[model samples]
Target chain A: MSRLRNRTKFMNKFFKSAIVGLVIIAVLIFLHFIGWLGPVEGLAVRIFSPLQQGTRAVSGQGKSFYDSWLKKKDLLAENSQLREQLKSNQIDVSRIKALQEENELLKKELGFASESQLKHVAAKIISGVADPYSQTVVINRGQHEGLLKGMAVVTENGVLVGKLTEVGDGFSKVLLLTDNKSKVAATVQNSDRTAGLVEGQFGLSFSMTNIARNQQIKEGDTIVTSGLEGQIPKNLLIARVESVKEVESEIFKTAILKPIVSFADLSYVLVIIP
Target chain B: MWYKYILWSIVIILAAAGQVFLSSSQNAIMANFDLLLIILVLLVNLSSFERVIWFLVLSGVIMDIYSSLPFGIFMVSYLLTAIILEALFKNFFTNRSFYSLLIIGSIGVLVYNLFFLSFSGLIYYLGGSEYFTNWRYLGAIGWQLVNVVIFLALAFLFINYLSKRFKPVFLHS
Candidate 1:
């Protein structure tokens, strides 16, 4: 009789608690529906901000420790050799001059970056998604720092990295170009001046299609952002053409590109604010 | 009574933070085991039905905060998954066996991912999926399977290791 009473009491308590939990969940869903969750999300980011930074730091230290411990002597020898090569290369100034001449030739054809008025804010990328499934990173800048959604983010060398998709008060998330869902309007910097839509495909590579069949594009041509409608600036270097596929029956051809800037090595970027 | 829940909340929040950190740093994408799933499965095997339900609520909240998707999508999916797992646990499955653990983990992953993707697809479509629907989720699901295998093996080892002195107590409970 006592055991039965105890079991009945537990059941009653459980049912009451369950109802409370359900009500709580329902309230949260309603709150989310009305878009009152941004402040709450900002709070969560604020709380986890230190943890995120610490994780990044620890991982960096661990990697650096492993590298130095394994390659100390070898790195010293390579450093001396590199220093010697640098002295010799400094005397060979003509090599840089020739590269500059080739760069100017490419720019003359594209006719971009001459009259560009650049407005940018610098931010350090605190952490990045290592998974190939989604390419995103959390940066230290946010609404207080004037980061708005759809702002174009680029590297120090003016290479397009991604755009700000979500921004909070203290943090923001960037969506990378290599992400499988990402799409960018790009133009080829060649004599033909072909324009196409670049789309990420198969989690591993990108294919830019929609080029007219008669447009002439070489394998080694460079591709840059179309900068359509003044949101994302035009002529930001995107990728270089590795191969082009043309089907006579189709109106559009596709170009396989090798992304110029290495996404893996990115640690900082400048957000182009409008 | 609610103190244990508070403690578990702290633990889950820390685990979520760790999951975010791990996925973000050193490119450890291959080792991206779902820490949240591992914790919930352990609780499902060990806790009462009502407790699992509450934990699911907590799980949903954490995932919503951590994920970039709109709020409550994961919360709803997790609540449904927890109820199913609870039903299976309370009436059908034994918590003591290795095979049960394996089966539960595998099926749980499939159910959770499909449910999540369904909700995601709906929300994104409703919001207009012009460029948002090209994710390679099939490949990511394969990776999730690998993660499940690894995490379950470790969990089993942890449980078996604890059986040294409290074998009967640990196994039965």
Candidate 2:
């Protein structure tokens, strides 16, 4: 009889629980269908949310009471991280652009490095300090690399830019061909092979003098180093002949030569060291 | 009798609102703390089943009204949490020290949150909401857990303190 009562009690409990569970489920389903949660929460929040704030205020410091939800610091941290990432990305982009420019410069320099007889040291143009009186540039290589005074400073395209005048342990200075005191022995690259002494005029242009009035120099004639008798090498590019002028009273004709390379854009340079 | 129930209900509602306020004001990468759950865990553990069961129901309904979850979702989760806890905490704990209360509250918040989040997700799936919030599982859960630890400590301390110093005569001595 007790066993029967136990079974009966068990059934009764099961049925009751099942019924309660079903009722709960049905109510939840109806509420969900009606979408009443939003309004209810809104009203509750409008009425009671302040109490939560009050609770926080009373619990401790403004910080202690707000507890885990003072997430401004977290957001600030995330903002900082993202900002750092963006900064790094920007740096990488600029680095890529610089590398591309260097690659192009190196590709142009490859032939000069290989075809030249003299050993070459690549140096970056640290600065171009040209005044009205002289045009000079500082390079990153110096006497430590066996760079001596009077070594030819040329661009990647074999254009003779300057001659090294002074050297230090870590840097050297180059006197550009455009400097007033600069002098170079050059020959016009025509069939006539007219030779002349080129000298700088006002740190701007070079005047090639001592060419005979009858020399076969013309417009756009290429001028190169005569390699006559100095530490300078032959075939070093100087400039192109812009115009040849002749005066009846003068013994030799003059040609105004325009430099093939621009000084403002010079970055990478090769020092031709003997 | 039921007047105390009304007072407790008011307290629970206010606490829920304060949590909501804090969550809204704070800018975060989805790091909202479950303050309501922490408060409920304290209440459930401290109050008797007969007296607090109705309060739990009212609190759940209030939370459901306040929450973005479906109407019955928080209601159901709160009810289930109270029921489960009412049975589980019966005579199991006597120590009400600061550390003991904090540890117990942490475990309670963890369990309640798991249930709440799971039930809400189930309801969301049933509701056919197209937005699948996978982000909530990763960083949000971690931050929420941290929140649970910190908030539980505070909630347990505050409620435990009040329950100690300000006991009415009708309450257990």
Candidate 3:
């Protein structure tokens, strides 16, 4: 009877200590979740950022060396071919000038709105997805650089890859469009006629669903953001149609698409922090 | 004993560093080997339940600090895994056969994946989306299976090497 009482006392003390420890840990975790623990994150980034930068610098230098020493002849040949084409195409000067003016006008229009509305913060891709299972990439810019969550991240070529999901002090996580949770309001570029949603299904591909089967969608058509919700800019390249599947029971047809930017080769990205 | 703790801590730190550095490289494979999970299992098998619980708490704190997920998720998962292992496989703790480790490690991997998937699904549901619609849960499971196979083979080789080097320490008299 005495031993039983002692055991009960021990259990009570143990439980109380456990509860206290758990509460303390929980509070710490909560503080870390908010911006309160920014210093720690900053320190971590500082310690690790240099290593990434060093690796990139080394790789870049190596590539430049290879290009100069080994690929110089090929580059020269290509340059001469381009020069010949330019000479042959000289008769279309007026048409080329008109096309260039129109292109400039369009670019200026895009630049004005994109600059005013969304604060475009340019960043380089420090690293691609760390894990095969996660469709996340890391960018050099972070909260200190004015990056925030929900920022539409795009490639330099204006292809939408993802959005900034998490921000540290010096680094941020870009949730790629290939992630299963990613969804964007998109439309057919050729027609600007059909509007639908683009969603990532967790593989190498994304899918556009809820399009009417009768819509004149083809295999080679381009899809871009509709910008209906204003989360992303209008006409940003999303993907190219790969396959169209018609389901008897479903009201809309689904089209599988290949994203414009190759995620594996992603090196630099632009974060649009509006 | 102090040296052992220091050594293990260094190993964990190194493994985490490798995970962080390699995760960024363009050519590096994204699949992660659950170093924490392996270490936890090994420690629990070699130690007492009280010690196991303490280690679980410590490891949970470290993982919480390092992981991208919400802090308590891994802590809860690791604590539950430790408890389950202790309760169910107390006898198998002494059995260090390669086959046993493989089977046990595979089970651990499955449980870990299921826990995370269910947790993510719950989060998604609360956030107002169909959880299973994103086929990532399936993909993660497949990837984790591959991770399990690699871990098993590597663990077998590592444990065999360790046993040979420290036969008296690992083997029961």
Show the colliding residue pairs in model 1: none
lDDT of each: 0.73, 0.65, 0.67
**Tens-digit lDDT track for model 1 on A86-190?**
888746589889999999887676442333468888888776542324677878788888888888888876778788877876778888887766778889998
Best by TM-score: 1
Residue-level lDDT tens digits of model 3 in B47-157: 655555555555555444434455556666766566556544544534766766666667777787677667656765685223322457657888999999999767766
Q: Which order, best to worst by lDDT?
A: 1, 3, 2
- Could you tell me every candidate's TM-score relative to the true structure? 0.72, 0.36, 0.65
Q: Report the lDDT tens digits of candidate 2 across residue range A15-104.
A: 454346447655654654444433443344334434543443443354444554677789789999999898877466888999999998
Better by lDDT, candidate 3 or 1: 1
* Model 1 alpha-carbon miss at residue A190, Å: 2.9
DockQ of all predictions against the true structure, Cα-based: 0.19, 0.05, 0.11
Model 1 CA deviation exceeding 4 Å by range: A1-26, A60-116, A129-132, B1-4, B25-30, B125-173
Provide the lowest-lDDT 10-residue window in model 1 chain B.
Answer: B128-137
Per-residue lDDT tens digits for candidate 3, residues A111-150, read 6335545467788766543334567766778877877677
Candidate 1, residue A193: the lDDT equals: 75
Please, what are the lDDT tens digits per residue for candidate 1 over residues B119-166? Answer: 877876787333233346546777999999999867776877776543
Regarding lDDT, does 2 or 3 come out ahead?
A: 3
